[model samples]
Target: MTGIRSGSLVAAVLSLGLLAGCGGGSGNQPESFENFTAEEIYKRGEYELENTRKPKDAVKYFTEVERLYPYSEWAKRALIMQAYSHHRARDYEEARGAAQRFIDTYPGDEDAAYAKYLLALSYYDQIDEIGRDQGLTFQALQSLREVIEQYPDTEYARSAILKFDLAFDHLAAKEMEIGRYYLKRGHYTAAINRFRVVVEEFQTTTHTPEALMRLVEAYLALGLNDQAQTAGAILGHNFRSSPFYQDAYAQLRGHGLQPEARGDSWLTRVYRQVIQGKWL
Candidate 1:
């Protein structure tokens, strides 16, 4: 569904008529379609997809091919193309169903990789802005993980890996957003909980530096000077070049203190674990 759905595949679909030469002309005729061979009907689907740009009609023909000859090789190819056609038409649920069916029926087929990718994309493409429910993002992450782990050498895996990282970062960003909301309302402990999730569980995310800096803000707001100072110290040590670290340093300095690990708070535990090889 991303980036034009492969124009090369569309081109090949359009060329199927020439390759077979049996029903190229009468394939689109509804009256002739029922009498057409499996390949001919499948080709008609591709013809609608590439030439007429009618995916709904393409899906009709593709589905018919699958229904008429469920065990034929053309049925296998038609089923996957049905998924592609549904995806191109933005019928994501239908696309997912067709894609999942293809994967279940032909797990070892070469096109199964493509079917799995389509299934993952069915979820990945639904992710909206951060304010929406993150259930879709979580599903996207899981499906993308499948593509990465099961087909790591494929191009689909590479794309899935990239999307997986972005989805992971999106989760961290959501935590940061809620953390900032709590911090703005002076709910320091609630804000700290959200920021800590990013620091501890989402350390690789870009939001971690900001989360640590926010911990400094929240702890300082709660008058937990040692915790605030320790948070600032961790920010400066791990993300010295980050603007968040600089802001944390300024926040600590404003309190007549400086960045140093001088607390027994959770952040101090993190610092000990990271800097002193101590487990908490």
Candidate 2:
């Protein structure tokens, strides 16, 4: 998962120190924190994060600011930083909780966009590779979509858009990965199902050309010449110069068929949309 930026985190950490509110309680552990003002505790969290590079320790102080001065604006600011600290420490669940609470309690706050973005990042960052469960990628897409739609004018929205695209592509890559695995295992039907997902739903992704090519291979293996030709036709229609298209063309020729969409297959619909501009 992506951690909070040290520069932004430090700036946010220091900014809250400008606010006013003191902490006091004899029973509180760490006598310094007990006596420090809310801003001071928040500052300590910043120091821990920036100077000490100890985000786990930083989270402690930021959490304390909210607990001790829950009503202060510093508390609100600290809550977001607390989320950042948890994220930097790789405590994704805690980061998500703190960020979600910030959004819930301060929906109209300027930092709400950042909080929501952080919540999305919590999931996005977890989607490391194609092997990971796609559930996190789906969650990231939903959260990022909310950010893009809800706060379009914000900087966070712009970043969310980029991340959303990357996550979407990642999902397609996962499908390609599984399809390739099944294809190598000689499971043509299973492989075709996986490749079809990329070709249909993830058509805009970079994986689409390769997915179409894989469909050609899988269908040919299953003795489905019409489906194979249709897949090759779609690949050639949109990605003619691509290596995948070249490969599909070569494979179709081996079967004494040419690349042309001539069946009521899923690829034929894509050919209509992409080639004939007939999308509904």
lDDT of 1 by residue, 103-219 (tens): 999989999889999988988888879998999898899999999888889999999989899999999999999999999999998999999999988988899889989998998
* Model 2 poorest 10 in a row by lDDT: 17-26
Give the runs in model 1 whose Cα sits over 4 Å from its true position: 1-32, 276-280
TM-score of each: 0.86, 0.87
Error of 2 at 257 (Å): 1.5
Stretches off by above 4 angstroms in model 2 are 1-32, 278-280
**Model 1 lowest lDDT segment of ten:** 17-26
